[model samples]
Target chain A: MRITIIGSGNVATHLAAAFKNGGHRIVQVYSREIQNAALLAYHVKAEAIDRLQDIDPETDLFVIAVKDDAIFSLGLSLAPYKKLTVHTSGATALTVLSSIMPNSGVLYPLQTLSKNKEVDFLNVPLCIEGPDEQTTRILEQLAQTISNKVYRINSAQRKVLHLAAVFACNFPNYLYEVARRLLDKQNIDFELIRPLILETAQKVQENLPVEVQTGPAVRNDENTMKMHLQMLQDEPGLQMIYELLSQGIIKNTKDGH
Target chain B: MRITIIGSGNVATHLAAAFKNGGHRIVQVYSREIQNAALLAYHVKAEAIDRLQDIDPETDLFVIAVKDDAIFSLGLSLAPYKKLTVHTSGATALTVLSSIMPNSGVLYPLQTLSKNKEVDFLNVPLCIEGPDEQTTRILEQLAQTISNKVYRINSAQRKVLHLAAVFACNFPNYLYEVARRLLDKQNIDFELIRPLILETAQKVQENLPVEVQTGPAVRNDENTMKMHLQMLQDEPGLQMIYELLSQGIIKNTKDGH
Candidate 1:
């Protein structure tokens, strides 16, 4: 299959490589910055284009692997190549490109992609949604060439999953930064807690988060919690976060009971 | 060493087994309920004692593994057996047992221990703090028997590590629960997001979280965030959390610049 990728971000770089390596032709790569497009195009052996008017008309699929905000605007400009066009966004729905392209679909990879880090695309979960079953099947076939885990998720569920991903991925990483900062103030190496972080994630692999929950919050140890609050009295934002999350954990336990 | 362990909870259970496996004599296991003590004692080849009066005086090391609130009261009761005493708590300070026993110290295993799961104690970081040099050395030797990664951390530093740990382990696990609940509402299986959770944790093992942070907040994508906020309007608590954390991510980026 011939493909024209319409972004130069992390998702675009990875998906383009995966598709190219999976025996597909990368006809062209487009970006607002010509140098960025040229850099990605050089690696994928595709022509680089900064303007949408110069996109290949004969490409089999147009993958708009750009930001959620840019998808609609880019779709409006690529009206000529609307056939089987797909956007790789977890939040945006197929309706965003509905009027521009009836054959539009979604192919959201449920993984954190970094362009510098080579991700094993085979293990990444590819979530595909389309206006029709035929479009879904074609996107699934394209996804399967690079990944083993593929699922048909609708727009609503995909948006919810994206929200959950923020909690599971983005929020936790921020909390880790919070932890790192806390350790830094006390001259403690963040390395000491690395094993604990790894083990916490590993525990949830076979068990539910509720079953594996452990801490001062779960134990209802008011003394240590008070001490911790006193320790963070100066930093009100952290204090609020600490208080809110503790309350959430306590409330969840009560709800379970 | 003849070790008498108090409290039959998760920490006590794992520590008892580790000590027994590490060639220490299990003198006794104590709990408010005799059955709980006996259950753990049965596994470690130790006698079970419910009352504080029945504690063996000949034990070389006394380990108090009870809840934070109970530790001080339990220490008062165990005044007769205060020789080389240690409490396995993260947020607790050495002064809690200072007047009750001058030979008191701490042996906090910085990992989420569960009674059912077998942890590789060799890798678990044992944070020890003693009242004096000789006491610290003795506690360090005992800690070395069960784990390779043992650090002689002071009370202030240990408490900081404890606080950091709450952010790293406890808060992250709770965030995972939040994600699970979000997925549950949509009838989406939590298993789908497992890989993302694992990969997110894995990325932090080798890289600083600030370097690897990703999401709508980090990207500052207002469209998707606004959509998420509207979707979460019904749950005010989650909405507040989303706002606070997003602001935190954005603030961190600005601070970085």
Candidate 2:
């Protein structure tokens, strides 16, 4: 299948490469900045185009892999082709494409993708959403070629998943930075806590996150909690984060499992 | 070397087993409940003693692996032994043991330990802090026997690490639970986000977490963030967490690197 990729960001680059590696032809890569598109295109062995009008007309599928805001305009531009069109966005709704194109869907890869780091595409969960049955099946088949884990998720579920991804990936990452900052204050190398972070994440792989939760909060170690809050006295933001999250853990743990 | 483990919780059990495997004899395992002590003792081929009075006189080292508040009282009880004593606590100061014993230190294993789950003891980072050089070296030597990674940390630094651990391990876990709850509302399985969690952690192993931070917060995707905040409107607590953490990421990212 001939695929044309729009945008040149991390998600776009990763998806484009995965598609190419899965035996699909990347007809052209599009970016507002032609050089950016060219860089990605060079890796996938595809043509690079600066304008949407220059997108390959011979493309079998056009993937609008741009930011959420850019997806509507890009989708509008590609609607004329009537080729199977999809956008790799978790937040954008299928309705954004449903009215414009008869064959429209979403191929949302639910993982943090970075262009510099290579991820095992097969392990990345692909959330596929489509305007209709055939389009959904097509996206799933396309996704399965590149990834082992693919689910036919609806627009609502995709949105929920995206929001959840923020908590699971983004927010936790922020917490890690907070941890780094805390250690930095004491001149302790952040590397010391790296193993603990890795093991914590690894635990959730086999066990439920809630079931395997451990901390001063869960254990109700008030003295330690008091000392921690005192340590963060100067920074009320961190103190609040510590208090709220600790309370949340205690409440959640006590509520049920 | 003969070691007696005080407290039969996760740390005590794991440490006792590790010490035994490292060619040190675990002379006794002590807990408030004899059954708990006996259970751990059975695993490590040691005697079970519930009372402090029954602490083996022949023990070379006494390891107190109880809760933070319990450390002082337990240390006081074992003060007469005057053996090279240590507590496996990140929060409690070494003074708790120093006043009680001539040779006191800390052998804090900085990984989340659960009795049900077997951890790779070799990968667990042992943070050792001793009152004197001699005691520090002894603990370091003992720590080296069970784990490949060991660090000489002072009380202040250990406390900082403990606080950091809350941010790195505990708080991130609560966020994971938040993600799970969000998915649960939509009847989606929590398993889907597990890979993202794992990869997020794996990324930090090679890259500074702040360097690899990715999300709407870092990307400054106002549109998606708005949608997310709206989605979480009913739950004000979660809404606040979303806003603050996102703001934190935005602020932190912009500050430096």
Model 2, position A73, has a per-residue lDDT of 82
TM of each candidate vs. truth: 0.96, 0.98
Q: For candidate 2, report its TM-score.
A: 0.98
Rounded to one decimal, what is candidate 1's iRMSD? 0.8
Stretches of candidate 1 off by over 4 Å are none
Clashing pairs in 1: none
Quantify all predictions' global Cα lDDT against the true fold: 0.90, 0.91
DockQ for each model: 0.82, 0.87
Question: Model 2 scores what on Cα lDDT?
Answer: 0.91
